[model samples]
Target: MKQARPLPQYLVQRFQGWRATTFGENRSWYRRLAEGGQHPRAMVIACCDSRVHVTSIFGADTGEFFIHRNIANLVPPYMPDGQQHGTSAAVEYAVNALKVAHLVVVGHTNCGGVAGCHAMCSGHAPELEEKTSFVGRWMDILRPGYERVKDLPAENQIGELERQAVLISLENLMTFPFVRANVEAGNLSLHGVVHDIAEGTLKEFDPVSEGFSLVG
Candidate 1:
């Protein structure tokens, strides 16, 4: 309880500035959103990378997306073992409660989580291999992705692995019974996209083509 602390001064000032400008100008919109509750059109599973601005990338406003951020933007295979599953819970709510039509998994370049998975798989990061490491356990969800790209040149693994993370998550999303039902009924769609940080471009996976294509 003692660990709680006040927000930094810069953030406080930034919030005040936003309240004065954005909030002041859009007060009615904010009020309507609060009253109506969130009915986002999509659910975005994305990396917790600070540089990945999911909202700005899609030109979406508040209440437009139900976003869940985690390391590597991974979705673990569905396990209804009565354990605490934050990502799964969010997926359930977005799929069942919110009834979102589109579910997008967003991955990005130079992801620290993907790199850690590579290091751990290659026995280079013993720290991440330990059972006590929360990050290690979480990154374990992407091991299948690492295994798929392990044989490629070391230089090529990172980028490919990043995309694999997105694909793997999309695959895992179907493991959820509710998600599977919705997809089967044509009520929901799954998508995977990788944002190239250096190039500022997006690549979307096409299941029919079995590859990713440039997105505008």
Candidate 2:
């Protein structure tokens, strides 16, 4: 297979122009963000996909959200021992260090990572273990969520899978001592959200309805 070429120089040059636009137009805000520590109202766990930026999706300004992005936006259960756990560490810092008031686990429809769950649960791709692909390991986090909702209709499985995975992550978020303490004390709230990339609409999980509904 031919190697993919790098982004063209014109696009790279345009990147600087975009940054300059933000920097030049928002100089005072950038300076404040640099000098004063971030005090975001919410912490968002989002996907690493280039198209699914949480800030832009939420129409947020600088320093509005403490954000962490990983494959499929999955968060693992807490572990006490030190590990190179990028996702967990981000949660710890956002909740404990930054003390954000809200934590949102944002899943999206038609996600490549969630779709990969069907293959993972079926164990049809053994080659994944050898390649050590990032998607393979990250998909493992969804196994529990998959098992919980596997009996649902094939068409509905992906939606339930994504939603339940966010719920699992929200539950896992509480495993961290700080998050648990803060949430139990009513100082912090947890939310599960799903974004439809094609439509540019957001749906948040409603405990009363026991399903996802439009956020607005």
Candidate 3:
């Protein structure tokens, strides 16, 4: 019989600290949340990068934002093929069940996933070209975006591709009928954001300007 291992000491200590301090002071609020359930007004689809602190950036408390994180914050086109689609499922639940009023797709600078896609597309990473490479296969969703920036100089291409991730995800989100209907009815709004990791700066996409403006 196999035995289960204990959690890492660092994580255990951190959880204990939170339980004793943060949770202790907010016990009543936690209890209320447990009973009342979450009714967050926004759904944030952001990259699964440790540096991208979604709640911290927005100053959101627990249960305020329904967030889903994935590589490069990419959203594939809607495909009702009855396959397992984690991102799509999350989006569906957030839109239909949670009835979130806003949907935000966030991208970031120096993203590893975007870098990987760039490498693979530039014929620099032959290993990712193999059919068995999951990252490469998943990154196929960003090929269209990659094509748009492939012509730029190598140094400038990555940043443009990173921004493209947000644009592509926003464009793909509209492909969902529910998302489209809600957006058209003014029930939900879609936004694209990009975070500059090193500079601690944020930029919001403006459809009118067709560009990203730094958020003050």
- List TM-scores for all candidates, in order: 0.98, 0.89, 0.97
What are the per-residue Cα lDDT tens digits for candidate 2 across 1-216?
A: 479898899999998897889778988988899999789999999987787878878889878999899888889988877669989888889888898999999998778788787667866666544457777777878888889878888788887887877887887887888889999999899999998888998999888988789977
Model 3 local distance difference test score: 0.95
Which runs in model 2 stand beyond 4 Å of their true positions?
A: 1-8, 129-131
Each candidate's lDDT (Cα)? 0.96, 0.84, 0.95
Give the Å error, residue 149, model 1. Answer: 0.8
- Total clashes, candidate 1? 0
User: At residue 168, what lDDT does model 3 achieve?
Assistant: 93
Q: Write the per-residue lDDT of candidate 1 for residues 55-77, one digit (tens) a residue.
A: 99999999999999999999999
* Full ranking by TM-score: 1, 3, 2
Give the TM-score (vs. native) of candidate 2.
0.89
* Cα lDDT for residue 66, candidate 3: 98
- The Cα RMSD in angstroms, rounded to one decimal, for candidate 3 relative to the true structure is 1.2
Residue 45 CA error for candidate 1 (Å)?
Answer: 0.4
Pairs of residues clashing in candidate 1: none
**How far does residue 69 in candidate 3 sit from its true spot (Å)?**
0.6
